[model samples]
Target: MHYRVAVTGLGIVNPFDGEGEPNSGGVTDFFQRITNGQSAVSLYETQDIPRPISVPAVRCAAFRPELRLGKALSTMMERFAQLGVAAAFDAWQDAGLDKEYCQASGMTEASGVAWGTALGGLMAFERGYRDFWQHGRERVPPMSVVLGMNNAAAGHISIQLGLGNSALTYSVACASAATAIGEAFQHIRNGRAKLMVAGGSDATLAYAVVRAWEALKVLSPGDKATAPQACRPFHPERAGLVLGEGAAALVLEDWDHAVARNARIYAEIAGYGANADHMHLVRPDQNGQVAAMNMALNEAGLSPSELGYVNAHGTATREGDPIEIAALRTVFGRHAEQLAVSATKSAHGHLMGATGAVEALLTVLALHYDTLPPTAHLDRVDASCAGVAHVRGTALRGSKVTSALSNSFAFGGSNAVLAFKAVR
Candidate 1:
């Protein structure tokens, strides 16, 4: 028998405040700021680079993980894992699954963790390299290996939450987090686990990482004045994507189990579809995107007309934005003209592996509140992206959004789409 998967809780460690201050309001504040069309992207400069390159990007400037995870626990992990653990803890608490409550209820063994990150522990490794190459040090940090591993986030979350079922990690470029969430949903739906923490975290703001992206010529250019408006998806003059670093998590529980515990249901994770282009390593294919959307809609038993909104994977890249819009047009046909579409990356910047989780969380909130967050900084929609009903300038409130989809198309041609429905 297949069980239903429900999203009971949500958490995020994002640059929601945009003022170099800590965001204490968790997911509630995240939703409000996103809908209000705020931009967290800012001009960031590399300290270690000799030339000191500056670019428009989003960084968790105020994320002091030591405060959230405690000094001892935080010291053992790198920034990626630290962000993941903090987000997971918040989601666990939001789900009402405290350690005492879980132990008393015997819910530990049936729980698991699935996380994603494309450049896990890159910061830690960079520090070690700087010490050895720049400072001429012979020894690196003792915990470097453990802290720099890709699975560190999942392992820490699993241990902290007393989850024994499984602790898995995915590193599928930008699609990593969406894949993690999709697989976690499948695990619960297939009766393998009753509850799962699914999310992704990425911290690739290291000098080397930023330099590599600069080599690709896909990063948006900005100084202090233009940084906040650098990522304008669907806009005619949109330059390119802005890199970001953060984490977001969702608590996926079996429907019956959550109902039994009287957990607050945020939304139902109705379907997930994952596939690859198999054509190009970097370029996105319209066929692959359309196929993924069709698969998700089929699994959800939903038609094109039933999906009220689409959180597009609009990276603001010229080629990428047009292809994604074309795919949506093909999949939705005539309904494409009416379906509300927006890309939150316009506000929060692209979080690499963590982008999907953050956007998915926003989509869930959109369904729950019946409000559609706009694509920030979209002054003029490109003609190629004109078929869809773009949400711009400000949020659309009280629209009765019953179902929605979140799309994640990554650099390696991997595509993942998640379908959700309001619990009401």
Candidate 2:
């Protein structure tokens, strides 16, 4: 029998702060900021590049993993792993499975960790390379290799949580986290595990990462001197994406298991679909995107008209946004006009591999609360991307949302789409 998956808890570490600002700390604060159209994109300075260019980025400047994680472990972890561990801790606590309590109950072995990241421990990797090549250091830190691996975050989560089931990592570019969460949901659905910590993390603000993006010429222009609304998705004057760093984790449990435990169910993981385009390295294909969405809707037993909202992968790039709109229109037909399409990246900046996990959590929260976050900075819709119900200006509240989808179209032609439904 095919089992169902339930989202029991969520935790996040984004550029958002609870200091009456746009930074999202947790689920509630994140929803509030997005609904308020607050932009977290700001000018950040880094020595990763030669001249230290000022680029628009979203960073968790306030996150002190030491306060949450112990000093020793915190120091050993790189920024991405730290964010992942912090989010995992919050998720574990939120799910009412305290670390000590879980160990006491002997449930650690039944749990697993599945995470994703595009560039793992990027900051440390850059530093280590610099030290070895430029500074000619005799020896690097012992933990440098451990921290530089793409599976480092997953390994850390498994160790910290004492999970022995399995620890898996996906590196499918931007769709990484969504793929992880989807696979974790399948693990629970197949009765392989009763619970899992699933998410994605990336801290790619290093000089090499930024310089690579700059070379692609897909990054938006403007520094500290410009306004926060630099990356405007679907706007007529849209520039490009602003990369950010963050982590998000969701606690997925079996439906019957969660219900038996009397746990709070935020939403149900109804369906998941992923496919690849063997076409281009960077440019997205409408056919591939449509296939992904259709597969998800089909698996969820949902029609295009039944899909209330879509957390679009609107990276604000001219080539990407219009193609996404075309795919939606083709799949949803006339229903596309009634759909609440919102590109939240306009406010939070693109979190690379971690983006899908963040958006998936937000989508589940949206379905639970019946509130759709707006696409910030959508001043004038581009003529090519029009004809859809783009939620702008304010959050669409009190809408009867039965199901929603989060779309992640990454580089390397990977497309992952996850479907969520209200826990009715």
Best by TM-score: 1
lDDT of 2 by residue, 1-424 (tens): 6788999989998777646543336778877888899988899876643487688888888887887788999988889999888888888788888766547767776789999999988788788888888889977778788777889889988888888888999999999999999999888888899899999999978888888999999999886767488889999999899989989999999899899889999999989989998899989999999999998898888999899999999999989999999999999999999999999999888999899999999999899888999999886899999979999978999999999999999999999999999976
Q: Can you write out model 1's per-residue Cα lDDT over 1-424, one digit (the tens) per residue?
A: 8889999989899886334345465788889999999998999986554778789999888888888899999999999999899999999999988856556678777899999899999888899998998899998998899999999999999988788889999999999999999999999999999999999999978888889998998999999999999999999999999999999999999999999999999999989999999999999999999999998898888999999999999999989999999999999999999999999999999999899999999999999888999999887899988999999999999999899999999988899999999978
- Show where candidate 1 strays beyond 4 Å: 17-23
* Clashes per model (N, Cα, C within 3 A): 0, 4
Compared with the true structure, the alpha-carbon lDDT of candidate 1 equals: 0.92
lDDT of each structure?
0.92, 0.89
